[model samples]
Target chain A: MIENRPLLNLISHLTLCLGVLVVAFPIWIAFVASTHAPEALNSGTVPLWPGDRFLLNYAMALGLETGQKTLNVNLISMLGNSLVMALGITIGKLLISMLAAYAIVFFRFRFRMLSFWLIFITLMLPVEVRIMPTFEVVADLGMLNSYSGLILPLIASATATFLFRQFFLTVPHELIEAARMDGAGPIRFFIDILLPLSRTNLAALFVIMFIYGWNQYLWPLLITTDEHYYTVVMSIQRMLSVGDAEVAWHLVMPSTLMAMLPPVLVVILMQRLFIKGLVETEK
Target chain B: MMSNLSLANIGKTYPNGHQAIHSLNLDVEPGELIVLVGPSGCGKSSLLRMIAGLETITDGELHIGEQQVNRLEPAQRDIAMVFQNYALYPHMSVFDNMAYGLRNRRTPKAQIRQQVESTAEMLQLEQLLERKPRQLSGGQRQRVAMGRAIVRQPKVFLFDEPLSNLDAKLRGQMRIEIKRLQRRLNTTTVYVTHDQTEAMTLADRLVVMNAGRAEQIGSPLDVYHRPQTPFVAGFIGSSSMNFITGRLDHHQLQLGELRIPLKQKVDFNGEVIVGLRPEHLHRGTDYPHRIELDVSLLEQLGADTLVHGKVPGLDQELIVRLKGAAPCEPGTRLSLGFHCDELHLFCANSQQRIN
Candidate 1:
């Protein structure tokens, strides 16, 4: 900037524009595809431009009975299911990770390090690798086809715990001592001091975890057998699995757009806090 | 209200077997400001923390008023501490930060408000009460930290280098402010700082600590003039004391080639280290003890001049403090004198005061 490198600045701008194009192109195609009728997309290389069937395709997607027997499940019900699952996972993970990190960092109980390492080891074993066993446990507990089966297992990851722990460690030891001098016990300190200081981290983690929970496909696919329990992301696959037809590209594309809307809105609205949280938690 | 604090043979040893504080004892009178001064790693902070109930008293008992408070939490000990960093709650308003303790105690809302408002007014933080700590200046934030402690009206006030984070000019101003506030509040206070100036200026009674033990504890002047140990003597004064190793004979002190007779008799006659303060050295030949020096360097401070040089056959460097600016060059010869009463003789082996 001091040297006024116009050429370099131009090059950087061009590179960023290209990156944006690469990411946005798919969503653009999905939008175009969702606006067309089934026959419009079935013919030669799918249409690049919007068609006249926008309301028709979306209406079918949100309809309780789409008139096609195979795709009878309502997109409205699936969206509701996704919202519940995302909120559950985000809140559950934040609470569990925060308390765990606080205990591990502040208290000097026996085997504290061992317990921390044990929780940290869960980072290595992702939910995907332990899917069958997790599913079995969920099934045995009578949680199959329920929201808990879709969310609880995925909430047990170590990423949030580690982030909270790292943030807690960076807090000055003096604050804790001062709080103690103020006569605040552990819970009071957490609510009064620690929680307020961690606002950005919580907001940022919520964004990441909400997206993580919303985009979950394989976990929800494995657990939820009942049509009423299907999340939007997993139910998209159900819509495309119509046996002999050309995969209802119009209906599937609209559902895909709807499925991605909530997380995108969340990220866009809370973008400032999200970036602050991300940068601070990493520190 | 103020209460006396008593520490009976208190000690601290970390879990790794690092003995940070040995069995230390001190008694604080009501409304007294006791300062614990030392170099870092000297366990002054550990001692303060133990008294605040932030650290475990591994060996002995601690008493505040009539209660044995060694097992009590910091809150239960009826103490409030102002940290070096000011430790104002970053997200809370100044009023909330001060009111947090009272709220935790379930104090009535009207009472909490009145106390917080009065403390804020006392610290002159009334206008900044609604501002978060980040919005305030360093000195303002420091006052808020003090307000937080003062609002509690605890039996004891603990300060752990609370002014160390300020600039030098600000530190001096805050030092006076803290002293005035402490006196006005009349609370039994224990302050810890490594700055000798703070220890000297603010302490009603000073405890000079070294390597986990109290080297000497007395009034500021008492500790400065009659230090019980070489460590205390060196640590208390602004300019370090000049020490000359020599042999002590019957009623006489023998330096390299000069034997000066003493005014008083001493018990031990072995080798001893004689300490003389720089200010005690005069430019004229009016004192009973005299020494000549070859000046190697001169530092002319506006009000006083520091003459750094060495005496013949003396291995250690000697410094002389002369009043005002002295027009003297390096490599010049000067004669300095002191009284026998100004001399502090310490045993060579034990570093304990001999007379």
Candidate 2:
């Protein structure tokens, strides 16, 4: 499709190289800040060079007494919380959404279209507004301060459902037909043909949903009152405000950097797979 | 060994009440390539789907070798299909794609690998086994699709316009390849295509379809030479058979004041269409089909020349095939002629063949 384009040819290699650096600036800042000492951060005399406080920051964030909750801000517990939330959401949502998408895209049902539209319209309603009612529902379920309370309400994701539905829609209806002719029933056909064909798309969605599940702040904060239920994002916010005289500059920087690492690494690693998956969809 | 496929009064009424296929009937003998050829809206694909059990037989029975498969699922039909887009799983390597069905059936790994490798070798896809579909060319992908089907070793093979996605040159190449493969396997193959050339060269018998119904079923040559219906005549040939409104009077077909020799004699012939193939026309004849035609255009395709010209009182210009290149200019006058036996007469009102 790009064969006839002479316009792209006119763009020079140097300009393209410059564009790469522009995108890398934020990532560079995260790493640079991560390697520095808390004193440099506290002095507000931003260092142009890497400092030797990497160990100091780590020590402060992980320490039990003054360094622990002051700078580190119980981030280890928060990291554990985020892991539970992300994994629970990713695995649970993928299964339920896939089943929903398969039925909507491939099978005959009385209210298939209506079900699709209901799910699709959920893509619009901001979760911010639904926090109160959703919190009430989670509380009514008696899941307060529990991991279920953290993961359950948002576990049934419309985004993953929508993405999987789109991917399933593109699967050549022939493959499903072929699977049907092969004497395979609905579940067998989905597992054998549709799932195998959809690996790339699924991987792409897994990355997207994993990041979203990991980074959720507002809902987790609103639902769980227990500090034990604090997710990684909430831990970062807590660390930034942990002190009276001076914020634990020591633990705050490293803990914040650590909190952001998983999602950043996820994006970096899965970006190639995501791009390849997108192109495959066009094919 | 081959399998018989029969569709008995199969009709598909979609949920929205669109009858995509209605009361379609077809029977296939073992080991024959049955080609379903038709226009876009025709339900050729639907009929094939019904036979394969990919689609439910809405109001009838579908039998594969005496088994009433109306309720049988697609996998139970014991048939494999080659899709139009080749539907080779995009992310899988060619070998994995071909081996998938056998693996699903729990054929041992060694046997599955051997079958897939052998099928790949046959399709000349050995080198392409490790490659993903995106890496392979269109023709290679098509071969991989065929390999996937062949590896199943099913009772029948269903092809839904398998070569439609390739370029003309590759399509011609793949058509020959597919026909040769089908001949070797002698599977009871049902190929659905709208391309007349594919239908002509590949089908042992052609099922010409229109609007969810079969129009005619016969050998490619039989459908071409003795078209039972006017649609078959117009569809089977390129430079589609010209339909000129004329009166079949005794012997000759009188179009306006011009007359062409038509050997058919009918009792009642008030209004009819004279179906003349482009190749059937001639440059010389004694009892000539002489018409004063203006050369609208000429397409010289190396071996033969297509003379596009208009006759007097006709709203549309017609095309005539000339053997070898003809040095004809636009707006020039030319005389065209043909024998009386070449004329195909059809009722102008009913659109059915007269002779």
Query: Can you tell me which runs of candidate 1 are displaced by over 4 Å?
Result: A1-3, A64-71, A281-283
lDDT of 2 by residue, B256-303 (tens): 777665545666557887788999877765745566679988899889
- Output the number of the DockQ-best candidate: 1
For each candidate, what TM-score against the reference?
Answer: 0.97, 0.84
Q: Would you list the C-alpha lDDT of every candidate in the order shown? A: 0.90, 0.81
Best by lDDT: 1
Clash pairs of candidate 1?
Answer: none
Candidate 1 - CAPRI tier?
medium
DockQ of each: 0.61, 0.40
Query: C-alpha displacement of B225 in model 1, angstroms?
Result: 1.1
- Where does candidate 1 chain B have its weakest 10-residue lDDT segment? B283-292
Q: Total clashes, candidate 1? A: 0
Candidate 2: residue A159 lDDT (0-100)? 81
Displacement of the residue B325 alpha carbon in candidate 2, Å: 2.6
Q: What does the lDDT read for residue B152 in candidate 1?
A: 92
